[model samples]
Structures are given as C-alpha cells and as structure tokens.
Target chain A: MNEYTFPIVFGVFIGVVTRLYLLKTDYRQYPTYLHGKIIHIALGFIAAGLGTIAVPAIMEKEFAAITFLALAASQFRDVRNMERNTLNELDQYELVPRGKPYIEGIAIVFEGRNYLVIFASFVSTLAYLVWNIWAGVIASIIGLLVARKFMSGSRLKDIVDIEYVEPHFEGAGLYVDNIYIMNIGLPARQKEILRYGMGFILKPKNFNARSTIANLGQRQAILHDISTALGVYRDSGTPALVPLAKRDLDDGRVGIFILPQEKDIEKAKTIIGNVPTLENAIRMPTKSEANKKGRKLR
Target chain B: MTHEKLILAVITTNSNKIAGGAPIFTCDTREEMESVATNLEAILDGIAHSLSDELLIIVKH
Candidate 1:
C-alpha cells in the first residue's frame, strides 16, 4: 500500500527471478532440480516482502540488518537440510532413444536480465529509498553474486573436464552417449554432479556423453587370431560405418567426447574433430598440496 | 579439500588398483592421463548414478 511496499516487493521478486535465471541459464552442463529452486526463490521473495513490512514497524534503524541476517540464517538452514536429505531410490531402467519422442518444447518468456538487476536491488534495501540507485545497483550485484554462490560450481567444473571411452565392452548393454549440448560450464559458483548414462534414463531426449562400457559378453570369432593368423592385415580400402554428426546444442559447434564403438573406430577417426590420444593429450602436472592457485580441470 | 583434490585422490587410488601398481595414473603420456581421467570419472559417475548409497559412503571424507 505504501511507497516502501512497492519497491520492497519489487526487489524481492527481482531477486528470486535472478536466482532462477542464473540457475536456468548457467546450469546447462549440470543438474539440480530447477523447478524446486524456483519455488525456493519465489518463497524467498514472499519472505522478503513480509519481512520488509514487519521489520520497519518493529525496528527501524536495524531493520535492514535484522532482515538480511534472518534471510541468510533461515535460508542456510532450509537449503542445508535439503542438501542433506539422502537419496531414497531410483526408478526402473527405462530405455529411450535420443530426444525420446517428447512433446515439442517447454515455453517460458524471459523479461531479460535487466529487470532482475532492478528487482534484486530493491529487496536488499527493504522497501526504502534511503540510499540512491547506487545502493540499489550494488544490492543487485550482491544479490546475483549471492544467488550464484548458493548454486555452487562443482557440476560446471566437472562437465568441462570430460572423459572419453574408446569403445569398451561392459555389462549394461551398449550405450551410445554424448553430453547434452546445453549451455556449458559453471555460472560463477554453482556446483553440480552430472551423471551421463544414468541421467539419460531420466531425460528421454537428453543426449548423453558416449560410453565406453557395453554388456556384450558374447565374444565373437577370435579377432586377435584373425589379426595374428593374417599377421597384421593391410588396411582394408573399404570405409567403416560412420557415426552421425549430432548437433544437439544448436551452437553450430558440435561437442567432443570419447566413444566406445571400435567397429566405427576408423569412421570416428574422421568424424571426431580432435580426438586426443596418449601421445597428444595434455598431461597437466598434478597440483601439489602447497599450490593454492591451481588450474581447475572442470 | 578442493574439488579436484577430492576427485583426484579417489581416481588415483582406483587407477592404482587397476594398474596393480603405484599411483602413476596407469598412463605414460599426457594424452593417456586425460583418457584415463575421463574413464575414471565415468567410473565414478556410473557408481554414483547406479549406487548413490555407495558413492555417499565413499565420499564421506
């Protein structure tokens, strides 16, 4: 109803949206239930709005400090608890092809990052124009930084440091995989644990990183003897089966990863851009414990 | 501990087991180390995905 209420509510709303936006935009490489985080942030806004009104009436000078502390404390408690909740179980292993025939796409219009910038500024000020837009601007930065911090960067880091398997056999059948070409890398400080093959089970269309493991225990005719009996057969002029170039991320830039199909080994050699081997791969020196400024792999 | 440190410690230990030797990453070159790292990470991920309970147990440190 009052002037303070408008800005306070506006600020809180902005803060929540910004938090959600970063989580959505930057978290392409990793997984954290985005839906739940949106809910968490929206509730944070409602809490901020209510606190803005209630705090000023009770304690004017210290209202900002009190509200901020309360938010930090309460948020830490709830999120920490949520993080601690151990995994209960997993669904049955359902098989689905890439982009597993789902309804087109989910649609949500973005109001852009500018609105988020303004809204976050307002919440920190707590319904007051006591400081100029300078304060609001600072608050906006702080809000965005804090929100990203809340998310962490572990997932982003790990995704960048990818692994490739050269067509190895395993037990869970044959799984052709590649990382989902979403936005890559960490957004500031968001940490995530990304599961390639397993997550594929959850997301039908999610193109996962290729696997080197397969479950084909059935060993065919002795390939080694074939290689030995002939005593190193000359390279057959016939072309091997080629892997389809899948452009899932839409950046026009195809992704990189290791594959497990040895049959296509020859084709893959041509299809893959830069397949690093033991000879060419950059063997980064392992960081010593004393070195704090280490180059992060992920 | 740092993220890489935590991950590397487990990976090195596992690679050591696989190689039946010391923690040399079972790799002779940079390329091999990278490949080995990738497989090791996948192994860790597969473990996590298939056995979250076990991952939690192993990651207790």
Candidate 2:
C-alpha cells in the first residue's frame, strides 16, 4: 500500500465514522429527513478530505494548499447561519418554541462539530505518515473519544435538581410546588389542565445554576424540549395551553407547567434531563459586583 | 386579597368596533396593544393574544 493514498483513505473513513457517531444524538431533533442526513454526511466527507489532503500537500512542499483550510472555516460558518435560519423559521409554528438562545446554541454546536471532524482526520493522517497504520488507528480512536467528550455538554439536570410536582389551581391561579404560574379563567380549561397537565420544580443546586435557570431563554428552552419530546397539547391560537415557566423570586427555584398529549411523566422528565444547557443562558453571579452582594438579577 | 374583585383588561387593534359588555382599549398598532395586554397580564391574571385575528386579551380572576 502506498503511504500517501492509504493513509488519506483511512483518515477520511475514520473521520466520517466519528462524525456519524456524534450526529446520532437525540437533542436538537431537526433535519431528520434522509435528504438532511445526506447533506450533513456529504459535508463531513468534504471536511475529512480537506484535512487528509493537507498532509500530502505539506510533504510535497506545496504550502499554498493550506489556504483550503481557511475556505472550510468560512463554509462552516455559513453552515451555522443556515442552521440558525432553519430553526428560527420552524420555531414560529412550534407549540412550545425553542427560543433564540437555544437556536443559537444548536447552530454553534453544529459548526463546532464539523471542525472536530476535520481535526480527527488531520490527526489520524499525521500519525499514519509519521509511524504506521496501526498507530494511525490508535490515534483515530483517541481523537474520537476526545470529540465525543466535547460533544456532550452539561445538561440542565447536571446543574439543577428536577423533580416532578403536582399541578393544581388555587382558586384561579395555577401553582406548582408553591410557585405561582399563570391564572386559569375557564373552569373547563382548568379541569382539563388538572386532568392532563404535568408540573416540575427546577431547584438550582448553586448560584451558577440559579442564574442560568432564571434566564427566560433558558427556561423557555427547557419547556420547549420537554413539550416537544412528550407532545404538547396546544394548537395555534390556544394560549392557555402553552407551557409556562415562572421563577420564584424568594428562592431561585423555577416552576414549570406543561399540558402534554401523551401525559408520560417519565418520558417528560427524561427529555428535560437531556436538554443541553444553553451557552448564552449561563450567568455567573460571581462575575458581577452586584451579584456578589447577593442581589438577585434575572 | 381573597375577597377583592378580579380586574380584567382588553386591548384590541380592531378599530372598527369594540365588543359589547366590556370596557376595552384600542391601539393603532399591535405592539402598543401587546405591551398594554402584557403589563395587565403580569399584574392581574393572564393574557392571550391572537396574531391572525388581531386581538390582545387580558384576563383577571
């Protein structure tokens, strides 16, 4: 086997395999169609080729070929914007909308993943060129493990304690674990809520988690994910049935109320637990002087 | 607070006519009506807005 050709092919194969493995996650369940999968996989193959070809180009003293990396960077950024646009358009029709923060987070993750694939292929090819094919295989495994670790970010459950709570209405006001949510006007609607609704209390484990949960965008993401996974019970123009998340000012705990069609509490909890914490929604209390003084800021 | 009567507010963009049996505020733009409705909803009970029908409703109970 020729050194250059075999290493390049193996590197590309490993890179594409790693990319496909990472794409098998459950969060951000969009672009599920066969066409969408094909597009991403094709892009991953291109990224792998770019990385694997760089080693041969450099070995041949063709330094100008490195410019292709810059092109790939810009192309991936376009991928980010495309993801943001598609998700934003889809958000309009969602019963529990994934807010802007969640969409931005998803877009950034997708862009970063392409770069990871490139890195994996580049490292694998370099190891093969230096030593042997066996060494390249080991390098590929290590590269994939690192990429997989980077892919799994902190979830809401990692930072906060999520517990199922009883949903009840005190007079006309809805309450979840003593935190007041919204008010229900119609008795029939209230009856429906009591019958089919599930409630949860998100108790922040620490200051960092508290501020994160306090973010309206973060709470909306949590509600959207759970509602989407468990199936929300609202149609267009039905405002009362929309999922709501309200924070208790006295404490940092947040209350969530959702009317899901399936009413599967276990599935809802699992979905909520798996929601990736939005990057923009994380607020560090110690970073600001006002927060250091224990002044609560939402 | 328990014995007090609930207050309700209705904000609508439809200037043609106000619905019967309730005092409602009319605004030229949907933004203004939504602001009024949201503020009322926060203080009182709840708010519901319909974009297609052009209605901003505030309910208190």
Question: Which one is best on DockQ?
Answer: 2
Per-model TM-score versus the true fold? 0.33, 0.81
Residue-level error in angstroms, candidate 2, position A72: 0.9
Q: Model 1 misses residue A13 by how many Å?
A: 2.4
Q: Per-residue alpha-carbon lDDT of model 1 for B1-61, expressed as tens digits?
A: 5553132222232233343222244345434444454454344432211111111111211
Candidate 1 per-residue C-alpha lDDT over A1-298 given as tens digits, one digit per residue, 9 for 90 to 100: 8656655655665556564555463212112367655654665555445434443544456544555545544554554344233111111111111111100000011112222333354445542455654565566667777655543322211212222332211221123254341221111101121221111111111112111111010000111111222222122221011111222233222222221223333333332212111111112333435332555322
Each candidate's interface RMSD? 13.2, 9.9
What lDDT tens digits, residue by residue, belong to model 2 across residues A209-273? Answer: 89899998999998888777778787654556768999999888999998888887788888888
When summed lDDT is taken over every stretch of 10 residues in candidate 2 chain A, the lowest stretch is A25-34
Q: Model 1, residue A148: what's the lDDT?
A: 57
Q: Candidate 2 falls in which docking quality class?
A: incorrect
Of the candidates shown, which would achieve the greatest TM-score relative to the real structure?
Answer: 2
Model 2 is docked with a DockQ of: 0.06
